[model samples]
Target: MDVTQVLRMKGGDGDYSYFNNSLLPRKVISMTKPIIEDALTNLYCDMNFPKTLIMADLGCSSGPNTLFVASELVKSIDKIRLELGNYDEPPEIQMYLNDLPNNDFNTIFHLVPNFQEKLKKQTTPNSSSPRCYISGVPGSFYSRLFLRKSIHFVYSSYSLMWLSQVPEMISTNKGNIYMSRTSPPSVIKAYQEQFQRDFTTFLKCRADEIVRGGRMVLTILGRQSDDPCSKECCYVWDLLATSLNDMVVEGLIEEEKVDSFNIPQYTPSPKEVSTEVEKEGSFMIDCVEVSKVNWDASTDHNVILFEEEVQGYNMGKCMRAVAEPLVLSHFGESVIEEVFERYTNNIKISMSKEKTELVNVTVSMTRNR
Candidate 1:
């Protein structure tokens, strides 16, 4: 396969959605849902929504957290339905859940019944009669997935940053690619270019999918506007890189490959996205707030289980999300364990250093009416 194609394999292994679930405390989740609902409310005009208005989670992975998003949607739907007091005619809320083909649908399917039940309880006769119709649409977000103007809202959590592939330059230089994430700047630059292209296309696609009055709330990684030094500024990448270095010193991996690696250019500032949203003339800025989404999975208090799951074996999984295609060569598969632990520990240290720092940013906006 081409180098770019290989790089996409990086995301298949350790999805952030899978881990973010355990990390977010109940109180934090409680606070976050309102912000999302408020955005959706503004977009849909206070849940005076359609009888068959559609809401799609663009990158709905196979994790329990998917329901958290679903529940949030239902919360707004129910609240609005009660206020509207149309017991005879409730709006039809169709929930379209999507993700990459490789995502675990078995897990996703298992959650559907419970998700439906929860909505049913919150939804009175005044809510949409058919209730929220939940279904899975498995495909790439880069392409069109819905019928024309058939959608009212779209939400993609932590998914837009994945590029279609590694750069062709890396594909052409596969044999000589860096093993270290920080080993070379050229590889990093190539990946960043791909991210920009991918993001532009994503905005365009979403712009097309939603009606002029429709809205989309996209949550992805971002850097501070003032962080002039883009290189290695991300806490996640820094932690991962340091871990990889320890593995290299222990003779677990080749130094050149580890040094050449870097995080994908997924994290963009609010200003950057706001510029594109306006440039496309597709969406108007409803809210563009930046805050850290990083949460510490306490291994010290929770047990070794949290530690092991975060990085012990999943470090490479996280790295491959952006590194696999960028680094064509390999340094034996056996050393991956050591690589994983160091990778996870670095994150642990970083998280420990800052308990309430703003790390994850979500920018919510609406299609121009």
Candidate 2:
């Protein structure tokens, strides 16, 4: 199956939608706020505070989080302008929100009026605010999405770990939907090579579009261990595979169906990311930092645990929001609820024994002259 054609977060603001379950991503954005603000400040000062600033949020999936990012950008720049006493002439801002065509752009568009009104209220009475123009650009970021040297800054969060497609050799990966401890050496090698190729293509495309000295900040799902199958990186998928296997044992789904499924996602190490950036040679790495967030970080810790079920259920809902579309496309709709049900139970058992965390890698870079 072509991943680009089918891959997208579950849309709309419904209970199971990514729009509602994206607290984890919102946490990621908050964790990286200092990095983002630093990058924007450097760009503003380095460009001598240009009267017009052009930026884009790549893979900006729909919801409040979508405009939440835009709002952050506007506020950061406004703070810089306020510090510099440039209230009389705030720069005009052109912000592009890009995602796959399958993403719910309509939901985002409907929220723009409210976003603008909030910005208006936030502006001080006598101070001028940046006149911001927001537009949606629907397409894959792996390909060229902007004019040459036209963009000033770029940001993406909780995206980029997804490959353009599953590796051609991945069909040999049986009994697993992602890299796991049991995956053969060949399967692991194929995933690594695919990420190298895809990440390089991404850098080359962006190098051509971002002007010299323009900056990009990316927060990707990543692992700290050099071992690709480390528990922190692959345990979630292992639990998911076990869930499918249980259904297979019950004859609810064919064994071959589970054998054929694999996610088009890879979590690279910091070394892997820096290696690609150095090889691509278009951008200077300002910094690469790793952070760990608990699977239940968004949930209330005050909740009394009835045998630790809440954390598992919350994680199950979060994973479902992110993975349901891909799973639905592959297995059809009938098994969605049952599979996640089993998956949630497996998580409850595992979380009882140990805490599970997601490792995120945040990279800040600037285009070389």
Clashes of each: 27, 0
Question: TM-score for all predictions?
Answer: 0.76, 0.96
Q: All models: lDDT?
A: 0.59, 0.89
Give a tens-digit lDDT track for model 1, residues 1-369.
232233333322244334333334222344456567777666555545556678998877655566777777867766654555545465667888887665566676777798888766764543453467778887778777888777888887666655565454443322223222333455555655676677778877887788877878777655675332353235455555666666667876677775444333456667767776777777777777765533432122354455533532343344433343344344445655565556656655554455423344567777776
lDDT of 1 at 288: 77
